[model samples]
Target: MRNSTLLLAIASAMLLQAAPAVAQNNVPIRKIKAVKPTTELTLLDRVESDTHKKIYQYNEYGYITSVMEYNKEAEQWVLNTDNSYRQEYVFNAAGQCTARTAFNVDKAGNKTTEKNKAKVEVIGDTTWERYYKEYPDSTTHISEAYAYDKWGNRVEEILYGYDGYNRMEFIRSYKKREYSGPVDIYADNANYTSIERGRLLYDLTAKGQDDYHYTMNTNDLYVDEFRKVVWQTENDKLYAREYGCNRSLEITVGSIEREMWKSSEREFILNADGTRPVRETIRSYDETGEVMGDNISHSYTWDNLGRLLSNIRYKGTSSEISYKDEYTYADDYAKKLSLREAIAELSCGNQIYPEDEFLQFGRIATSSYNYVADGDKGESTYEWNANGQLIGGTWTETCTQSGPDNDNPTTVTDRGEIRVGYNADGHMAWKIDHSITESDFSKIEYIYNKEGVWTSEVEYSGDSWDGPWTKEGEWGNARARKRLATRAATTPKFIDDLTDGSHSIEKHDGVWNTYGNYNVTDGVVTGGGYQQTLISTASVPANPAYNYTDPLMPLEREEDEDAEVASEEMWYYYWNTDKGDWELDWGPTDAQRVYENDGNIVADIYDRNQTIVSTITYRLDDDGRLIEETYSKGGNITYEYLPGTNYLLESVETAADNSRNVCHYYYSKHNYVDPTGIESIKRNDASTPVWYDLQGRRITTPTSKGIYIVNGKKVMVH
Candidate 1:
C-alpha cells in the first residue's frame, strides 16, 4: 500500500494537511474532484517562506474575494518587490460565485487581469453545476461537466476529449444514486469517524464505470473490493454500469463469460464481542443468483485483547483445509515480538465438477498448512530495552509441512529467536533472524538519511547483528525521493536506482543543474557530499490571482513523472563504489520523458546531439493499467492478464539483458518474486554452459561484452 503513495512533490504539501471532511451525505467515488476548486477556505493565511506570506480576503458569505501576497523583512510588512500575483473571485449580485480570475501584478503596483478559467454556478440550493476546462496550451477548452446534489454528493459526471477538428466531444459518463445504511456500520466500514445518525452508504454503489468504460461491481459488501477488475475482459472489451439497489452487473455486449453478470455473497460469524468478524464465508453466484461453485470460508480466532490467535480455512461444506495460522506475542504492547512459525501440514484443494463434458471431474489444490493450538505451543515472548524498543524475542510453534492429509500429519516443533538493534533515531538499524531448524541466522541492516528516509536496506547472514555482513541482497536506495534537494540523495537525480557508490548530486536552482558528489556506499555516510536544493525561480505561478496560496498547486503535475522530459541537458553517471568501480564514472547524458495526466510516465528517451540514443515507451490498457512496453533498442515485452478475472498482472515479458543498454523495466505494480538469495531462484537445470547477464538473463557463450553471472559467479566478458 505504501507503493501507491509515490506522489509528486508538488502535491506533497496537500497530503501533509488534513483532508476536508467528506460530506456526511455521500462519499464520492473519485477521491479528488474533477472540477476546479473553490477559493472558499476556512484558513485565510498561508506562510510560504520565513518572510513571505499570503492573505486571503473573503466576503461575508465565506467566499474568498481577492488574495494578496506580501513579504515581511526586517519586521516590516511590504509588497513583494520581485514578484506580483493576485486572484479575485467575481460574484453576481445574487451572491453567486460565477468566476475566479487570475491577475499579474507589475513592479509599479499595477495589476493586469488574465484568463478566468474556472466557472461555477449554484443553480438553486440542490444543484451546483460546472464545466471543466483545460489549459493545455494556455487556451481554455471544455473538457468535462458535472453536477452535485444539495448534500454535496456528485450525481452526474461526464468527460470529453478533443475531436479531429480540435472540438471537444463527449467521451464517458458516470452517475451515482443515493442510498442509506446504519451510521455506525457505515463509518467503520468507510474508515471514518463521526457520522450522522443516518448511514452514509446504507446502500452501497455496487458497480461503477471509469473513463475507460470498464465496469466492476460487488454483491457482498467487500468481496468485490478485494478483487475488483479494472478491465472487463482479456480482449479489448468495454462495458457500461447500471446503477440501482438490485446492483446486478451485466456486460453491454459480447459473451466474455467473465464479464457477464455475477455477484458475491459473504456470511460472517462473530465472537462474544459481537463486533469482531471471526469467521467469513464467501460464495460466488451467476447472474441468476445461482451458486456457481463451492464456497470458501475463513475463520479467525482472537485473544481477549483483540490480538489474532489463529486463522483457519474451510472448503465446500465445513471441510477443514490444511491451511491455518497460529500467532504468538510477547505482550500486548510489543506487537511484532517475533515471527513464531508458519506451518503447512497438507495441500488445500476443492473438488470441481466439469461444467463442460470435455473435461472430467478433478481437484484443484495449492500448498497449504494447518495449525492446532495446544498447551504451551505457539507462544512467543519479547524483551524490550529501557527505551521501550524491541531488543530480543523467542518463538516456538508446531509446524507441519504439506502432506497427504491432516489425519496422518507430521508435526515438527520449530523454535527461533531474534535480536534487534536500533539507530539513534529509533530505526531498526540491525536485525538477526535465527532459524533453529537449519541452525542458520539471517541478518538485515538498514540506513537512513538526515531526512529520516530509509535510504539504504541490506540483508546478510552468519552473525548476531555483526558482519561479515557482506551478504549483499537487495540494494537500499531512496535516490528518487526528493526532500531538501541538497541531501546526498541528489546523487540519484540522473540514476534511476538506489544503489550507492560515487554519485553526482544535481541541485535545482530554479532549474536542475549539477551540484556536487556523494560517496556513501550502502547507506554509511562516507565521503563528503553537498546537501542543499537550489531555489526554484518557477517556485510560484506567474498568475497574480494565485498569489494567495495557489489552489491549483495539487493539479500541477511534476513534468518529470509524466513523459520523457525534453531536457536541455541531463546528468549521467557510469560508476559505483560496489568494489568493482562499475558505477557511473562517466557523468551526464541529455534526456527527456513524457507522461500521462496523472503523472504516469508514458515514454523515456532522449535525442542527444542530433543522434537519438534510445526511447522506451509504456503502453497501458484502457483502464490505465500497463500491459506492454517497447524500447528503441531492446525488443518488445507484452503482459498477460490475471487468470481469475482480477485486474492484476500475472507473469510479464521480462527484459533480456539490462547491461546491454537495453531497457529493462517493470510496470507500476510488481508481483515478481523477490530474488534476495540464491535459494529463492530455481535456476535453470540445463547442463548447457550457463551464463547470465547482469540483469539475470540466461545467455549463451558470453555474446556481447559486459559482466555476466557464470556458474553463480560474476565474471567480466569483454
Candidate 2:
C-alpha cells in the first residue's frame, strides 16, 4: 500500500528543491567538550561520574580528522569499550572527504578496523566517485557517476554494483533528459537481479511544467502493471492531482505470451492545494472486462490547517455507509485569546519558558464508526495544557449491540479515562487510568534519578480516588525479584491420583492438563503417557461424528511447495483403558496450531493409538494459491480465481446434505491489486521476531517470556 499523502509530500519537496535558491545567513559552529548528566549542579561541583570527556583532532584546514570518547574508570579516564567505537577521516586536497574508517574495541583492548575509501575522477561535464571496501580485497566494484549539462543541470546519474565474477551491473540509472521551454522530461530505471526471479526491471518517466507534472512507472515483466500520476497547479498553488494503476500478470510459455488476468481501474481525486486526497472511487470487473459491481466512493474532508475533519466510505454506490471517522479540534477563539493575554502578561518583563511557548491547538476529540448488525462506534476526547502537553483524556467504545429483534437495540459500552501530571522539570510525574469495564482505577508514580532519568515506577490500584490505595507492583530493580517469586509460585506440581493410578497437575497458563499413567520425577515426566499436539487445518468438519471415507493422504514434502497457511484450532483425546476407547482429554482448544515446513496437513491424530480421525488435504496452483480442499467425509470445497491473480472469482462448497453453496466476488476497474504483495510469504530470518498475543494484539516488548505468536507460528520463549 502506497500512501498518497506521503507521495504528494515527496513531490512537493522535489518541486521546492528545483526552485531558485535564496541566500541565507551562515550557521554558527560549536564544539562539545563533554556530555554531562542533567542535574541542578554547578559545573565546578560536578564529579567525574557526572560527565564523559570527548577528544577531537583537527587538521590545519580546521577539518576534524579524528574523535575519541572516554569515560571515567577507577578515578581515571579510559576508552569507553562498551558500545563505543573510534572514527577516523581522511580528506583530499580539495577538502573533500576521501576515506573514513571505524575501529571497534573490546574489553580486552583488541581493536578491529573497517574502512571505506572513495576515489574521485572528473572529466569534462562528468564526475565519477568510486567506492571500495578496504577489507578482504580492495575491489573498486561500486561507483556512482553523474553528468551535467552545460547549463549546470544534472542530465544523467548512474549507480553500478559488482556482479561478483566480473563486470559491473546497472543497479540504478537515470539518463536522457530533454528540456523544451518550460517542460522538462526524464527517465529513471532500476534493475533488480536475483537467482530465483532472474532479472526484474522497472522504468519511470516524468514530465514537469510550470503548472503541471506527470509521472508514469512500468514493470517490464508485467507489462500491464503500470502506474500514472498527474498534478495540476493554478496560480502557483496545486489545485488537483490524480493517481491510477493497473495490476496484471504476463507470462511467456514457450513462444506464447499469456495475459492471465488484470484488475479494474481505480482512481483518486486530490483536494485543492494537493495536500490530501478528496475522494477515492473503485469499480469492479470480471476477467472479460465486464462490470461486476457498482462504483464505490470514499470521501474525505480536512480543515484549513490540513487536519482531517471527516472520512466517509460507502459500500458501492449505495447510501449505506461502511466506515466513517470524525475529528474535532479545540478552536475556541475566546479561550485562545484569553490564553494569549495571560501568557503576554506573564512574560512582560521576562522570557517565556521554551516548553510553554506553544499553545495547544490540537485535536480535542475523535469518533469512529464501523458497519455492523446494529452499530459499532468509538469516541475519544483529550485535554491539553497551554504547553501542548496532554493532561487528561477519555475514551468510550460500544463493544457489542443487541440484534435488531426488539424496538430498541441495546449496546454494551466500555469507558476509560486517563489523567497525567508532570514534574517541575516537565517530566511525567504520575499517571492514573480509570476503567469502568474493570471497575477499578490504576495509578503509576514515576521515579527519576538526580540526572533526570527515569529509573523506576510504583503502581497502585484503588476503587476510588478518596479511598485507600493498594500498592500492586514496583518495577525496575525490584521487578526481577517479583518475577522470580511468581515463577516459583507457579512451578508445576504433579500429584499422584491413587484411585486411577495416574498423575495429574493443575492447569498452568490454561494450556496444560492431566496426563494419564504418566510418572513424574523431579518436575519431569518420564513414564509413558498420552501426548497431544495441534495441527493446522484448512477447515473443520461441521459434524464432529465424521468417519474416514478414504485412505489418509501422505503429507507433501516438496521443498518448492513449502509455504505458510492460515491456522486453526486442534482436537486432542486420551485413551481410556477401562472403556478400551478414546476419550476427550482437554478441549478443542483455540490456540492449537501445527508447525510443518511441508505446507500440508495429512491427518489429525486423536489419541495415543494414533487413530486417524479426519484427514484434510489442500491443493494449490503453480503460483502457490489455494485452489481446492478435500475433507475425509466426502465434503469438499473448490475455489476459482481470476487467471494469474489471487482475486477469487467464485467459490463452491458441497455439504454432506447434498446442498451446494456458491459465492462470487467483484472489483472496480483499474483497481491495483498486487497478488504477489498480498499472497507472497517470505521466510522469516529476522533477528528480532515480532510478537503478538492470542487476541492478535502486538506486544512491543513482552514483559514475560512465554508462548507467543512469532512470524505466524506459535513460539515458546524460555
Candidate 3:
C-alpha cells in the first residue's frame, strides 16, 4: 500500500531529503511507448536506483520481449537477448498482455555470464506461465508461473529444483513436476487502511518423487499496519506463528511439538525509520509453563557518530551474562589508516574474535588493559606509535579472580602474548607476536585494495624468521559463495499468515511440491483434515503464490489482550526523562506497544507492576540515518559509544573473570543458582575487551603482556 495525501508528500520529501544528492537528482526516467490501451505496464523499470541506473523492460501485452540494465558508469544500457525475457502469447489480434517472462541478470555485471528466463502463459481470466529449464546435468530448474486475476491479483506459482548432487557432479537427472494450490493475493490501496488478502503454495519434489509441501498466506496491510502469519505443514501441523510490525519489526514464534504447548518468542527491533533490525530477542518455555532455558536476547549498539559499536546477546542458562566492546584508532576519524596502523593499534596484526570469549574475559593476548584516567597503571605501560598504534606492551590483571580457578572458569582459556605490528588501511599488514611459555613467535602479512579495503593475508607460526604459514581472506570469500548458493536452493520458505483472520481461506486439489516450480493435477481428496490430500492434478494452479496474514496469539503478539494478565515478579525498567517515556529493558510486554495515526510505533514503555523500570529513546542521526536507540536504565543514561573499528566498544565489567556485569540493577538474587553479581562491579579494570571482525571472526587475544609498540609502528609481539 502507498501513503496518501499530505502524509505521502511529507514522506516523499523526507525520503528525497535523506537520499544522496547525486541519487536524488538522478531518478531513472522511464519512457513508455504504448501502442494503445493495454492492461500491462509496457515499460517496466525493473531495477530502480540512484544515478538513473536500473533494468528496463519493454513488453508486448503481458509478455516482456526486451530487458536491459542502464549502466550509469558507462552512460549507456545493455539489452539482454529476447530469449532472456519470458513471454506467452501468440495472439494475431490487438496486443493484450497475454503472458510475462521471468528473467535474471548479473546485478554486478561480473564476467561469469549467466542467462535468466521464465515461462509465461494464460489460462482463463488469470494468466499463468512457467519459468523452466533443465541444466546440462538434467537438473530441473523450473518455477511455476503466476499472474493476477483480471484485477491484477497475483494467484499462483509452482517451484521446482534440482536434487541430491554435489558441485562435482557431471550428470544429474531431474524429477517430475510438483503441484501447489492457488495462492491468496493481498492488496492495500492506502496506508492506515486494512490490508489486502493473498495466498500461495509451494510444491517441493525431487525428480518425480513428491515429498514435501510449503504453503504461504500473506497480507499487505495498508501502509504501516501489522501483518500476522500462521505456517502449517502439508499434514496441517501448526509450524510457526509470526507477527510483522510494518515491514521492519517481525516476531516469530515456534511451535511446541513437545508434551505440552511449548513455544519460542522472537522479536526483531528494526531501525525506527527503516526496515533494518538492530536488535532481536527470543524467549522459549517448556511444558507446564516452566522456562526451559532456550531463551535468547540480542542488542546492537552504535556510536553517536553512526558507527556500529557491538552486539550484546544472551541465551539459555547464560541469559544474565552480558558483553562489552572497546576499539582502537590508527588515525583521526576521517582519513583511513594503513593495515599496519590498524594492526599496530591493537598491538597485533589480528583482532576480530568470537563475542563469547571477549564478553567473558577482556583479553588482548595474555594482557587485559585497564583504563584509569589518561595515563594510569595498565594504560601507560602499553606503548603506541605517533599514529596511536601500539608497539610494545606488558600484560597485567585488573580484577581479582575467585573460586578454585576463578569462581567459574569460562569456556575460553586465556592465552597470553604481546603483539607488535604495522597497521595499513585499518588492517594489520605485518606483525610479530611473542609468547611467554614456549618463547614462541608469530608473524603476519596483509594485502589491501586501492579503496583501503583489506583483501588477503598470511600468518606464519614458529620463529619470527619463518616456519609454518597459513593464508586467509579471499579464499574464505570464495568458499562462502558456494555455501550461500547451495543454502538458497535448500532452505524452506516461511509459510505463516494463513490462519489469521486478516486473510480469506481457500482449498484446491493439487499435489504441492517445492523445488523450482509447481506441477498441478486435478485430483480427488486423498485424505482429510490436517492430512487432506489431493488425489489428482489440474484442479488448481500448478504454482501458487501464497500471501496470507494470520492473527497472532496472545503470547506471541505484543498487542494488548483482553485476557487477564497476572504478574509474579517485579523488575525496574529505565525511563528517559528527557524523552518523557518509559523504555522496555528486555523485550516487548503487553503494556508497551502503541501505534500512531500513520501506523508507526509511537511510544513504548516497560514497567514492573505500575512503576516504570526503564525508558528507551529513538532518534535519527544526521542525513536521515537509521533510527538510533539510547538506553536509560535505573536513571543512568548510556549512549552508543564505540572506540574500535571492528567491534562496538562498551565499558568493561568488573567480575572475577574480567567479564561484564550480568545482573540487572533493579533485580536481586534471592534463589539464583548461578549467582554472578557482576552488575555492581566497577569499570576501571585493566582488562581490554576483545573485538570481532565484520564476519564474526575473533581478532583479539588477551594476555598479561601489554600491546607492543615499536617507535611509531604497532605490532603483535608474541
Report the poorest 10 consecutive residues by lDDT, candidate 3: 544-553
Cα lDDT tens digits, model 2, 330-437, are 653212323223212222311122112123223344445555434788887778777656687888888555467755557788899988888988966777889879
Error of 2 at 66 (Å): 9.2
- Backbone clashes per model, in order? 35, 13, 154
Predictions: Cα RMSD each: 28.1, 28.6, 34.7
- Tens-digit lDDT string for candidate 1 (96-210): 4565544555644445545333556556653444444435454454544455455555444444454434443434433333422222222222112222212222122222244
lDDT-better candidate, 1 vs 3: 1
Top-lDDT structure, candidate number: 2
Which of the numbered candidates is closest to the native, going by highest TM-score?
A: 1
Candidate 3 ranges with C-alpha deviation above 4 Å:
1-130, 133-282, 286-290, 294-433, 436-438, 443-459, 465-718
Q: What global local distance difference test value does model 2 have?
A: 0.41
Question: By descending lDDT, how would the candidates be arranged?
Answer: 2, 1, 3
Instruction: Please report, in order, the local distance difference test score of every candidate based on alpha carbons.
Output: 0.40, 0.41, 0.30
Residue-level lDDT of model 3, residues 1-718, one tens digit each, is: 1112222322232222222211212210011112322222212223222322223222221112333434335555443332222222233244332322233334443212223333335576655544444465634455333444554434333334444354231111111111122212111111101122212112111121123322121111111222233443323112333333322323211211111143444455545432233555665544344555566665555333333344455544364534433333222232233322221222222222111112121222222233232222221134545654456554433333346855753332223345555554444456655655456666666545334544444555665435454332212445445544656443222111223222221322122111111111232111111111111111111100010011100101111111254432222333333543334343223233222223222233434343445433334334222122333432211122222111112211233233332111111111112212222212234233332121112234323333321211122323
TM-score of each: 0.36, 0.34, 0.24
**Winner on TM-score (1 vs 3):** 1
